[model samples]
Target: MGILEVSNVNKRFGGLQALGNVNLDVAKGTVHAIIGPNGAGKSTLLNVLVGKLVPDTGTVLFNGTSVLGLKPFEINQLGISRVFQTPEIFSDLSVFENMLIPCFAKRDGSFRMHALESIASEKDIIEKAEHMLAEVNMADKRHMTASSLSRGDKRRLEMAMCLVQEPKLLLLDEPTAGMARADTNNTIDLLNQIHDSREITMVIIEHDMHVVFSLAKRITVLAQGTPLVEDTPDNIKGHPKVKEAYLGEAAA
Candidate 1:
């Protein structure tokens, strides 16, 4: 069995069938990419994985434990972390200060923004945060305001924050969205580095074919809230269903 598994999952919104009977298996220590056209239920499935949304009739198991009904932070405690499309950070705070917030997170999922001022006396936490920042190549920008950084740097800092928590599974929603080519390439390199250096498993939901092809060990193509195909990157590239999903019947 894979480390994370979704079995017979279904979700609906009034008259809209947001997710059909969907299933996904993400093995340990591999990068799995889920790509599909707009409105293909990719976001819905991702939400289920992260505990933000519960499936109506399915099981989302992380290491054999059911994650349904758990809160987002509760899921985080289970070694799952999610990076949203837009970087989630304290815009006014310095990059280092933003990094310190996660370090002070309480077991009950509470954080004191003012606690940052007291972090100086916490030598170990400081060291750990600094190490993570350095790992993402953001150490030099530690004192810069998070809002002042470029989009790529913001992504780097956000990733550092997630890495500091040391999650076993990282879910990225369009990690390279809205990035220039240079930033996108840099993000790709950073993700490759992280994958090479850690035992973490990543599940990415992306629209960019380049990002998906560049990072995924396995790819699942979703269409109209169902998985059309799942295979290695090369096989997915030549998949007729995938072509029809993105392009019309002509491509297929």
Candidate 2:
């Protein structure tokens, strides 16, 4: 079995069927992309994976354990981390301080966010946070206010924050959304470096075909809240159904 599996998952909102028996199997250490047109339930699926939304009649299994009723933080404790489309950071804090937030919460059973005073005494966590920032090439901006950084840099810092947790599965929702070509390329290269350096599995939900083709080892095409096709990048490129559902014939 894959490291993460979603079997026959269904979700609904009043009269709208947001997800219809969606199924996904993501192998360990691979980058999987899920793409579809607008209103295709991509965000909902990501939410379900991260325990923000629970499925009505199916199962989400991480390493064969049911994650249905788990809280968001509970799911994080199980080695799953999610990066939202927008950078989720403390706008007032410096890069270094933001990086320390997650690291300071590592405790047994329950986790606590260490206050600034408490964090000052933990040399090891501080060092580890610095190392992560350095790896992401943001160590130089350690003291820079997060809000002052460019959009791309803010996204980089956000990813670094998620990486420090050493999650088994990383879910990215439009990681490169709103980036210019240069920033998009930088994000792609950074992702390649992350994959090469670690054994983390990623499931990215993206609308940008360039970003999807750049990082996806496998692609699942969703349409009208249902999965239409799942295939490798090459096979998905000129696929008739995929072209119909997402990329038009001209795009193909």
Candidate 3:
């Protein structure tokens, strides 16, 4: 069994079937990409995995334990961290302060934001945040207010926040959604560096094929709420079903 498993999962919203019999297995230490046309239930599936939306049926398991009914922080404490499509940060806080939030997230869904007095006294937490900022190339911007940073830097800070938690599995949702080409490519390189630095598993839901093929070891193509193909990047490159459902002739 893979480190993360989705078995016979289904979800619906009134008239629409958001996900249908979706089953996916993400092996440990591999980058798994979930790609598809719009409305293919990619985001919905991600929500399910993180416990934001419980499935109508089926189960999600992380490291052999069922993930159902767990709160977001509960899932995080279980070693599953998520980086959203948009940068989610404290606009008023400095980059360093923003990085400190995850460190304060207790497994019980309780949070203790360190005050200015405690912030200085918390030597271990500060050092850990500094190390993570340096790893994401944001060490120099540590004192800058998070709202003032560029889009790319904000994304970097968000990533660093997730990293400080030291999750075993990372879920990325359209990580490069609004990035320019240069920023997008830089994010890809950051992802590569992170993947190489540890045994973390990443499940990416991306619309950009370039990003998917760049980091994915295994790719699953979803079409109209169901999985249409799952294979290596090279094999997925020329698959006729993928061409018709998502990619064009260029991919085939």
Error of 3 at 90 (Å): 1.2
Ranking by lDDT: 2, 3, 1
Judged by whole-model lDDT over C-alpha atoms, candidate 3 comes out at 0.90
RMSD values, in order shown: 2.1, 2.1, 2.3
User: What residue pairs clash in candidate 2, if any at all?
Assistant: none
Give lDDT tens digits, candidate 3, residues 128-226.
888888888888998999999999998888888888888999999999998999999999999998999886899999999999999999999998889
Give the per-residue lDDT of model 1 (tens digit) for 114-178: 64456578787788778888877788999999999988888888888888888899999999999
Q: Tell me the whole-model lDDT of each prediction, alpha carbons only.
A: 0.89, 0.90, 0.90
Q: Kindly provide the TM-score of model 1 when superposed on the true structure, using C-alpha atoms.
A: 0.94
Residue 203, candidate 3: alpha-carbon lDDT: 98
The window of 10 residues in a row where model 2 has the poorest summed lDDT is 106-115
Clashes of each: 0, 0, 0
TM-scores, each model vs. reference: 0.94, 0.94, 0.94
| Deviation from truth (RMSD, Å), model 3 | 2.3
lDDT of 2 by residue, 1-252 (tens): 999999999999999999999999999999999999999999999999999998889999999999999999999988998888999998899999999877865443355443455657889889999999989888899999999998988999989989998989999999988889999999999998898899689999999999999999999999988999999999998788888877565665
Residue 70 displacement (Å), model 2? 1.1
Model 2, backbone clash pairs (residues 3+ apart or across chains), number: 0
